[model samples]
Target chain A: MAKSKKNPLRWVRLDNAAKIYPAAMRKNWSNIYRQSMTLYEEIDTVVLKSALEVTVKRFPSIAARLRRGAFWFYLQQVEAAPEIQEEKSHPLCYMSEKEMSKYAFRVIAYRNRIAVEFFHSLTDGTGALIFLKNLVAEYLEQKHNISIPFEQGIIDRRVPPKSEELEDSFLKYAGRVPASRRDTNAWRVPGEKEPEGFIHVTCFKADVDSAIALAHKYGCTLTVFFSAVMMQALMNYQKELNPNTAKHKPIKLLIPINLRTLFKSETLRNFAMFTVPEIDARLGEYSFEEICKAVYHKMGYELTQKHMSAVIAKNVNDEKNILLRLVPLPLKNIVMKAVFDRSGERKSCLSMSNLGVVRLPEIMQKYVSRVDFILGVQATAPYNCGFLSYNGKVYINLTRNIRDAGLERHFFEILRDMGLEVTVESNRN
Target chain B: MYCVKCGVKLEDTEKICPLCETEVYHPIVKQEQVPPNYPPDKRPPAKKKTKIINGVVLFLIFIPLLTSLISDLQPDGAINWFGYVAGALTLAYIAFGLPMWFKRPNPAIFVPCFFAATVAYLKYIDFVTDGDWFLSFAFPAAMYFCLIISTLATLLFYLKRGKLYIWGGFVIALGFFFPLIELLLSLTFDLRFIGWSAYPFVVFGLLGGVLIYLAANRFARDAVQRRLFF
Candidate 1:
């Protein structure tokens, strides 16, 4: 692909969800995560570098660096390709402002996996996954000399990047009606945090068919079923960890909804929102079936076109407010930080994001064995669970900064007792 | 392999999950060999020094110097007032500008330079006005203050223990320095020795004694830590 003689100094406004990340990002908490794909063969650095070199140009938004404006933060196109480093032992390590001042994302090649960790301000999981898949495809094309055509989610390097690819989808889909952002404080997980700020990741592998069948038995989607299972696990642990407070506290699960499906957005930037399904244990002890029923109905109600529209509109409305728009970026950051501290992570005890089945092109699928999505632990919500299923296997990745493995242990045990075989793996040596 | 607890995919060689510390046990894939992808450990990268800030500082310093030189030259053929301006500018450069040149400048060295600069400026002012205060009052006052500060700084830099005791000693020394300042002032101005300096001497002397007494008690230190939440 030839470099277009277009104006190189291009910049774009941050999407609605992207705005919160820049303000909330701190030294101890970067609000970043690594979304990676492991190939069947060892990664060749030379080929991987060439792949990223050509692929980043196709997704112009991913190649940009974050810049501060008078009233807001924007992404400015960078001329130099980002350096792809060897994979570090810990994934999603805290990125200081100093490191972020250079670039918003980095590519790492280690063994069979090529991971891209992005500062959340740049894009959401869906957008990031698309970029990674394209990089891998490009790598395969360059290394193996294969003609793998661009598929639905992956970008084609032969064509120039369209303007719509950088569009702020929230503004496009925002309606006039505003939604309520008020939420009661959810039960926070109790545990000791690793002093050195270590994050523990535990991945569980289950048969995709069995998990789906279990969800089907409850007459709900896989995400709802998983969320219910997670909430139940939290309830059991809360009973053990804080027996006195367990009855009063509400167990809520955060599900980050992909807005693209509902809004028909082709924008590769952030376009996701969250809907929290909460269960108050004070009412009574909830059986697994009852919890599943509640989660299914609540998710169905909240994720409807009108209800989700109000959620999107509310955030866009906040951003579009005359007073908020007039405030400078620094002052806006203070407001956003306060709002996030009070309302963002406080609404949920744990977050469970399901990337769903990651379908690849037949040629690419053969080389890819596992697909994983990792969400970093937030300041308040110390534990977060991410799910990605591929090739008949479901991978559940639980990320926590706290020392206790009780949550993960309980979660998998529940699934195992329910007659589904569960296999666990960890990076801990 | 993946961590059954956190669900993060892991390299096969890891015996435990790096994130959660969950032991790795895959029933299906046992020790089929591959070298570790990551290195043994990670060391944080060195922070990049911003050279541009030094350039900006130099430019800012140049502006005031150029302005004073031009204003002084236009009014007179000689650099009479410009010498004073140069002295003040030199002092500013030594205090602020010189530190930007090195990553870490020893406070022991800079502190002495600051004293020397203050003394030089005082001498310059005296020479200009044909005053008689530099040798009697200004020099002694500046030297005593500089000596006290350098002593405290030396103790802080070199000592690994008894910081509180050192501070208590310095406070006591400061209490004693007040009367000497008064004595020098009276001698330089040809005035009678008034007991005015006694107020601060009593107050600081009492406070210093109390601090020394507290520093001598281990229980006091522990109590302070508990009370202060340090």
Candidate 2:
């Protein structure tokens, strides 16, 4: 049935993974990520705005603003869609607290590209990609006067949103046993920070087939291959700073895993957790092959249905605690902030999020030239990497708040040495 | 084009390699007409509407000032007690509201102006009451308080390091200042020295000594920082 336009405003409690974002966020910094698609032609703002109005009606959970209650933070449906904005000089600008309360996500257009930046509290990468695909589908249909099929990640805007799509899947799938939340502190890359909170993003475009072949040669998936290379780069960079091997710390990378792939769920909210794969540098220096092997086995051991459920149970059970539920939101924020500072970004030197291959219908694919995924740097950590494969090419985006490009240089040099051709572009002058 | 240093392919829009900062130079192959990845127009986000809120606050403050003026003048043809209310309101606005007009109000400038206005307010009160205490008691007292506060504000605002030392010195100075205040009262009003300033002097002196010690010892500072790590 078609939903009434004047229906009462709906609100939902933040999902298990999302609850910490509101508390962990600062006045100038928030957990935000951007996904953009470049088309063959320039974008018309009027048509994009109208398309957003229609697309938002279909995704109630995504089209809402963050609100605070006495006990928890919730997402309330906005009366109208936020205005379409012009793209800034860079993607993922600092989203202040007031801006998040007004709108948790923004649609930006520049030249022939359309980008959507989302506050991580609103959704994970999978959910954000789905939202972006649907929005692009709507924009194409309106601008080109061609109907797009509701296949792949695109959704039908005419249909009402299903209850399952807005569900907190973690609450439903958590197991009885909670996982042990223990992790060792990792080595952090230190550098001079950019003044005035400027973020630098560098994107490397490579042939996906060749990269996949290299991964196959290493007997591992593309994510594991990249993780190993990242670890090696970090190790090399740290070794230069501290020549003594005995003083070295562990190198860890937090890889975010999409839970929908393991569990049977169709929700668009946050259903993702992370696994930290680390290497102890105190033992000895590792070769490229050794790092790859270690990362592959660690991913295999952690990315399991049983272990994922245990992690979910640990998070959900904390939310279910009666004493925790009764704590006021202000007090909860302080506790969560302290806990986050202690164990959140401290366990991982950086995050590597791979969205895998993105497939669009043939009709929709003709107009889209390329797609890019960019993750914002962590709260305390300086670097983050996000990548996605689309249309025979993989776009790997490295974002940092620091001025030194040693990590990027080392990373790309490794890929170049491996016989992979990388095309580099950046927002820097 | 390729980066001469890193050997990675560079886009036409890139003048330098993002990874290594190497200049891209190709004599035969000219730069293409392709647009850059991000937009050239780097528009910053709009600032908040602080001026509007400041204006609203100004209007709110004006309400009572005008009301008191009218109420004081209605009973007679001349301004009677309106000066006292106006002086207090003006002092309050100068201390609080004046800073709102600036985006980054410097304490070095505002602090002195606030204390000067405070002294003026006291002078006004003395003038209206026809008291003989303006030059000897009120002026010196206000100037002394102003000098201490102004120096503290200026030092704290300008100096980035040695905060603990500055605070320690400030507290110790404040401890001695109480006795001076008591001495002034005794000279002006012919009152006996009760030695009441000794209590505050003792407390502030001990606190200032500890702060200075912590400032000198790096180990103690680090320990305090770790324990109070928010």
Candidate 3:
């Protein structure tokens, strides 16, 4: 909501889940993810800008910029939307700290595609998807003179912003007993890094029915199936790199689970946690079936309401600690950065975030040709995988900052070997 | 068209399979002219503006130097206390400011330069004071310190692996070098030694031994890594 003259400025404390991003951000690296929709016609920047202007007013938390206070970082509402930029190089190009302080998200236009790249501190994929869908709906209504329905994540801009949508759900649902934060560090994937910081995005388009059938054959969900396949690929890569079987570390994939499905919160802020399902390579070789079973059970165990509440309690309790709260923001950032480096990306080889399936209203679906979700590679880790099914096809995006393509090759090859046809598209020349 | 090696279909814009780098070829189907997923314009992220900060730092360094020079020259016609201030500021600039000019400063180059600047500063001080200990104490002491540090920097910067081993060896070498420093001080300054160096040598020797052991023993290394969360 826009601040009145009496208030002057409206600011909100970063959510418990968002507090780590501002601290862990580097000069050239930020936790960024992209949600895009490719329409049947080329994007009109003039109309897109107007659409964003209207859409931003509906989501106050997503329309804010990061600001540093004495003890913590907060988000201050910006009156105007960030200028819609033309996609030049790649998706999720580094959003520097200077840029984040001004705008936490950017709207990008390229040909027929309209993409929104957001800093993780702003919102998770689910929240960002809702924002994107509404923005696209507005754009379509304005450009094509179509009256799209206000259902299925396309919020009505006429309604005032609700307080519940901006509430920090982590604090609301924290339990008394906190979960243990102890976890073994997973093996890191190594590759020759691109010197110029160019991100390579590769998309694998596969049939939704085929992938679902394969997942059903293994008696696991699609997310679990993909995670197991990714772990298998990582296992093969690690084995190729290190022949000594005894020295192999546990191969783990950090799978982000949307807490909205489990909890009864409707806030658009970050409301997701990770379930690290791993296969210990040090023990012995694991078959695909075994890996799938391991991932399925581990995810099931950690995805429970009690287990997730404990995890949320642990995070919220850290925010409530008096000693930590008294520490100044500069010193706090150093401590938070150290903590993130120790337990964050190091505990998983890579992250595979599946946004399950995206559905839009009937009126908005005709103009949209494709929808994609892309998660940037972790700051230290070189690779990350994100995918979502939109119509009958599933778009599996594999993004990496390194020169090696072994992981992508192995992952797609595994899918192809399972009798599923995969069509590949990439930004790399 | 599909990648022959990867067995996955390829987009029309893909000349080669991104996965296996296998060239895409078809018997009859020709590659069509189509726009890629992303735009052709490659706008790399803007690099941080270090030049402005470097200029500001230069200005900051100049302020103190100018103040000292003016105050010293105003007091006397010849420079007296200004030499000491200038020498120290010069060393500070060489150590910190000079490296800020490069995007990725080579530590191997900068480390040697910094030690050389330290030695030169010490020599300048000795020359100004007309001290007798310049050759016997300051020169050799600074040179030895430079040698050790430069070697450490060179090895750590050039070699990717064995960082633990290098640090361990360096620490052990320091354990031996401390005693030598005590001997040099005793010889140059004619001071009575209380065997203080041996205490540090014992501590460093044990610490260095542990580091080397950790480097050698993978099991211990992994255990320590897990415990320390390094």
Candidate 4:
């Protein structure tokens, strides 16, 4: 049943993985993203707005704003519907704390697309995807006068949210094990960054079957193959840019692993930790097969339940520390901000997050044309790549703040060489 | 239609690429001009009126101030305790309330202003009490405070790296400050110099020297950082 008038507004805590985001955000950087789904027809704003009004109520976590208390930052429930805007020029634009305090996310509709950009302090890509899927379902249902059942990550807004859906999975699944992984600074891609607040988004479209065939040929999954390819591209670029320093620097890709599969928790907040898959160029140049093997094996070792649990335990243990708890919020923000800047992007050349297959109901799939996931650029790391496959098409969206197209060119050339048809799209304003 | 620069596919209505601001142009495709219906500018949620709260607090303080002023007025038409009370209230206003008037009041400016207010308050107290210690004791005390605060402020503002040296200097100065204070007190009160201030001076002098030594040596600095890695 729909949340009743008497059902009190529920405020939730920031998930364990989400605690650092609010503190780490700056004017140029707020870890935010825009996950958009394109339809064959122009978006009907009226239906989209009404659909959001109902759908957001289902996601109490996303419907809330970030609030700082004496102890920690939290999500406070907001009763009003989020303002739906026409698609602006940029995706994943900078969101200030003031904006975050008012609304942690936004919904935009333009032409054949409806995108939801979220301040990652509220939800991760999975959590955001859940909200987006529900919104799309409601939109399609209202627009076409059809009832779309909630399944495959879609939720019925009429149903009240479960307590487990709102739980902080990190705290719930934390153990005594300590995290052991450490990374040296990775090779940085050198290029002049575009003007502040401007991001260069390049979407590389390729056939899913061909990409998968290529991955299968190498005995690796799609993500592993892509990681190897990206690392290879960076290694080549580093050698091209500065061959002397290339041997000294390691090429590492920071890949976020979803922990929900292991913890058995269904919370729609951030329940993920990143594993750094690195190649030591000092050891010598690695062949494509060797790189793929390294990436596949490393990802297999790092993404295990035991390893992920230890990572979560380390983060939760820090949060649970009595001394850290006693530190004032302002002081904690300063320290966390410093730690986030120094430790976040320094050890990774770039980030590659693949959201796997995006499945929709058969009835709803007719109206949807494509889905795109755009990861925001980091402070130090200029570019980040996010891929999502829907239907037979794979969308490789590269969000970069730099002016150089060398990386993207090299990346697409690799695909083209493999006989996979590639179409490059960009928001080049 | 597509943006020529960053190359993300553009909507038919879009005049330019939203991400890179590159103008959208396609030789074959004619541009359809439909202005986007963007959401109204989100007026940053009305900020809380801290100024009004400060005004209310100032008003509350004024009531007691007025009462004190009225009570302090003697039948002989003399402003006896009123001067001290009014001076204190003025000092309180300067120290606490004045900064609220500006959006971002610079600490560099306000720190000295606060010290001036404090010194003025001390002078007013000395005058009201008919004491002659303003020059010998109170002035030196205020100067000492200003010296420490200004030194710390300058270090915080200017010194970006290797600030331990500035800290060590401040500590050493602070150590010497106690002896000067003791000498001033002995001179003013006609008390014998019992050398009590020398104890803290010696203790802090050693501490400051050790810190200075650590700041001077690169090896010692790295070792301290490793040991105190928070």
Candidate 5:
């Protein structure tokens, strides 16, 4: 059935769940601290009344609520003082409005480059994507002469702020699901939460104009094809280290799928979950197209309504330690930890966030040299890849807790061999 | 990231240092919390004098525990229940004593587990040895202690860290319970169980040890880093 309402997007601020993850309020707070990094893109366009605006104006309350927290809060306020100590020269994200011009929206790039801060907290990528969309839409309407094309019956521009609910529809999907694989032995870690590092690299700018065509030629989106290549590269990396157990080793890649479309929520604290996709080293050694097809099929299965419900239900309820709410802080940590262990069902070896096809306005698209988003290297693994698309080009960034980075070359080599010319860049700090 | 623990330089070598780990020293006297790396606000008037005193006291305590471990390989008696007693007491002390060291604990679940585990240990040992008064009195006493330990531990953990605290307590009780329950049943029934059956108890102790160690070290390090307490 079609969603019951035209402005189906809704976001709810949970009173009970809001107090936790207080790290957001602490000093040196960035959305990235919670591992919640996002890019805010603005296209300064002479307002064109389009069908999309009609759909968006119907959802202003939804649009405005999205900017209330995290990256946007920092972006909109622009008064946050840097909390980093004077003695230290840490690369911190100080507020910047240098890009605001005769434009409809604000483009803020959040990069999670800190190597030591992954798995600190959970923020679903979908939540960030929705905020990005809302920020752009809101900026377009307010700053520029944009109007909703209500004649197209796109969406009713009639949402009163009072009518909106802060809660997300996908909240129903939250809970712990039965493990698909039983026994840690089958899972093959045997309770060894080992520290892993990555060899980080980049496949800098690929030909974005023909990205879809190249994808069709290779049988994948720029996301799946490259991710598959990443999978294969990781497998080779593992082989170089553990040659004896090469055949059965399952190379794991944490693939993040934005949940904005999956769950139409405008509230943007965290609304994304990732699918951990793994390929046997043999499967990893397959042709790029085959790996891409395999991943596409896997991701397709996960995003389905049936699978989304189960996954969402599992995550929320698994973290549903109500006792943590009622009990004192000292005593509550026990239950909180149980919640952590239960919710921490590792799906892959490293995190991969593909912010596919970043939109830019006509104005600032010129002087802006390039844009890149970063992912913090977490305990689950040594490195994670965060890539953003800007100005018809994609920038790949990797962060790791360990010093020597190795994912760049293998990633590019796989892409090159798969019939595509890709640019390369490295921030050798 | 400055030396929040002991004012020591932070680098690869100082990933997490020992002085910070134990938190025996603090340099500056600050209100509320200090930077983690800073040691206690004031060191003892004399360092070498204190270290020698601490070393002597530590050796005295270590000698007997070491001797008992080496001396009794199930010798001098039909059953070396002392091993069980010693282990239980240590668990109890760590669970209960350490937290009680402070009047107001930062995370308060530690004390009750000590008492409850101690009670369980005592009852388990008794039921195994005295076969005569096994259930009439022993089970109730042991279970009563278990209930208190579990309840207090659960309650305190919930208050401190929410659900995390409870999960931790459950793991602790479960870990210790493995050996205690089996030993109790074996004793009550007079079943001929081999030493191989007791292997799980070793695993339980190992798991218990690791959890306590990590929790203590992590807590201590965090406390130092936050400069919440000296």
Candidate 6:
């Protein structure tokens, strides 16, 4: 049954499998593909404590799933009466330092700041970004024991994507790139020699408007500029590793494109696909004009609706191969190995994901401190960077999971040379 | 006692409750009541659907194996292990994955159906080749390692949920446990078969124990759970 129209739209998870992974949070980004959202505003710790009181007063829905036959399924929920329990945890919430990663999506907070992540089915990033921002914004504004503005509590509930949008977008974007047997011949292939463990870096509060102006001046979106800058740094690092590396031919880059607008769905799982463009390392050193043009043209072609449809078809049909479905148990592992090897040959030298522009009220900024994004790279992301914009500012979260530490330093140096003074954020995690 | 579904009481005089009329076991001299509906009941039959679907899934699963087998089948060399792999998955889907949809489901039917499938695959290999190695070596060895643990786990869960499942779980647990034990002993000290038909008495014992327990127990009338969800 459809929910009461009077009830404000809130987050709804699609499944636990999607919620269990950290990647689900990073890629919650949607773009021209799909962009569905809902928002809650003017809620602070005092008000939030009160809002939870009101919010949880509603009925709770739970999903149960069984793994091993003898193991029974368990129940979980997105919303429930918090007063009935001491704490609540969501599926996506994680602690990297913990073993087994027995993670939950919800987190409890009677006081202090809070951020929430949802798989697209629950709420698109835009909705979550806004919800979290205003949640904190309203939380801080109330901290001073001050009077509230009437409109601050206002919320805008966007309509869920239609079934037709879901069907169309799913037909376009439900594509999975099979594990390739060939190494993705990216600019530089990672090896045992690269580093001890993958490298991770975060830079926050970088004057986002200036970066936007710089990006606009160069005729590119902030995402494009940041991506270009990341690649430029990686290219310089590669040159340092081996002088001959940079002088070699251009490298290919992989960027994730959300197909939200193309196809809409109230359910969220994997709704994005990869767009890999072969970029010349030389392009990073060229004028911003050259870099911007290349990025725009590449994204234009790779993120198109038609091509995405083709990809979806290929993903479905590819899995039907009898070799994959009927391989002997003993030999199934062998086949998977071949697929993985091929993937290395096709790996992207660098990958950039821009969560796009996030807008927030001025009041929320004080309590939020800042927002951060991190990409999972078993090692060697080619060059990996995540850009999330909030309050007209962008936070560039980078990790060289597969590259050497030298590469990270080179990236920052190149940013400086590009006439951008980048202030690096201290790593908290 | 009251009917579990509708809660109408059955009387000593009536064959079944007149209001809740399901088949009654007592007097009325075993004369059958009029079967609820007239000439035809149109809830839809599952046989045709289950058979067709089972056939289709079997075909879908087998096509790949057939190809792999055709591509790799040999006289006495490199047996098409891929066929065995495909065959195992086919067995899994056909046996465990397909039953939940039926209006009526009986574990009595499902358990033995899979039990036969497991034994038949082993026989197929040995029959085509006439070597006892597949059964003598792998059967017991594998049973001891995997089935023993799985059976124990199943029993633990049974204790947690309810003892009502013992009619099925108890018999199957033995079918798995004895062979596994024999297999382990044969490998350790060495023995002959323990000989085929060695567990006839054991099977009888398991069956008798369970039957006695069930015969003494009375089932409480309770509402059956049902739901229709995608």
The parts of candidate 3 lying over 4 Å away from their true place are A1-9, B41-230
TM-score of the first chain of model 3: 0.98
Which regions in candidate 6 have their CA more than 4 angstroms from the true location?
A: A1-184, A188-199, A246-250, A264-267, A281-288, A319-341, A344-346, A361-369, A379-383, A400-404, B1-230
- Model 4 lDDT, residue B72, Cα: 73
**Per-model TM-score versus the true fold:** 0.67, 0.71, 0.72, 0.66, 0.44, 0.44
Of candidate 5 chain B, the 10-residue stretch with the lowest lDDT total is B34-43
For A197-266, candidate 6 gives per-residue lDDT tens digits of 3233334336777887778877888767776766665555566655664365555566767666565543
For candidate 5, what is the recovered fraction of reference interface contacts?
0.00
lDDT of 2 by residue, A169-196 (tens): 9999998899999889999899877755
lDDT of 4 at A398: 91
Write down the RMSD of all candidates, one decimal each. Answer: 15.5, 13.6, 12.6, 16.3, 21.5, 28.4
Highest TM-score scorer: 3
Q: Clash pairs of candidate 2?
A: none
Q: Write the per-residue lDDT of candidate 4 for residues A94-157, one digit (tens) a residue.
A: 8888988888888988888999998887788888888888899999989999988768887768
In model 5, which runs have C-alpha deviations exceeding 4 angstroms? Answer: A1-165, A172-203, A246-248, A282-285, A319-327, A330-346, A361-369, B1-230
DockQ value for model 4: 0.05
DockQ of each: 0.13, 0.30, 0.33, 0.05, 0.01, 0.00
What tens digits encode model 3's per-residue C-alpha lDDT throughout B31-82? 8878888776355645445788998899999899999999999966789899
Name the runs in model 2 displaced over 4 angstroms: A1-7, B41-230
Segments in model 4 whose C-alpha atoms lie over 4 Å from true places: A1-8, A245-248, B1-230
- Rank by DockQ, highest first: 3, 2, 1, 4, 5, 6
iRMS, all models: 5.7, 3.4, 3.0, 7.5, 16.3, 35.2
Distance from true location, Cα of A141 in model 1, Å: 0.2
Candidate 3, overall lDDT?
A: 0.89
